[model samples]
Target: MTYKEFMDSQTQLEAPAHLTPLLEALWYAGRDEWHRAHDIAQDNEHDPMHNWLHAFLHRQEGDFGNAAYWYRRANRTVYSGGLREEWQEMVRTQLPA
Candidate 1:
């Protein structure tokens, strides 16, 4: 899936079943379902990708300190961009060519 495809999927009632957990979380995030996204991220805490998603969730929640911690855990730099831009980047990175 491309980033445009992923974004387009948001118009549906549910996220596509083929998405990875991180992508599902991003899907939920796009819909403003923060708790669902956070749950998916927290439940998959062992993966660096999930941690990065968790960081993004915290950042979106306006909890910068928690976001920083999760970013460190994920070995990703704390994102300084707008939430929408960061979300777009993450979705694009996870999507298949």
Candidate 2:
């Protein structure tokens, strides 16, 4: 499903079916459940996207140092924007066609 669709469907009792692990984590993040989001994100490959999301999670939790490390892993410059904007940017970048 498209990202807009995903966002729109988020009011449901369940997450969308057959999402990638990252999308599932994003879904949980959308649900405002950070621990669940991190649980899924932690198991993902230690690649850029995972690192990026992990960084976002840590940053969300206000752990700047740990977030910096993960941001390094993701090769992304440290973000100085609001979390909601950053989250939407993540969704835009990672969103499926």
Highest lDDT: which candidate? 1
Give Cα distance to truth, residue 94, candidate 1, Å: 1.0
Stretches > 4 Å off in candidate 2: none
TM-score of model number 2? 0.92
lDDT of 1 by residue, 1-97 (tens): 7888888899999998888889999999999899999999999999998998899999999999999999999999999989988888888788865
Provide TM-scores for the models.
0.93, 0.92
- lDDT values of the candidates? 0.91, 0.86
Candidate 1 stretches with Cα past 4 Å from truth are none
What lDDT is reached at residue 95 by model 2?
A: 75
Candidate 1 clashes between residue pairs 3 or more apart in a chain or in different chains: none
What TM-score quantifies how close candidate 1 is to the native fold?
0.93
Candidate number of the best TM-score: 1
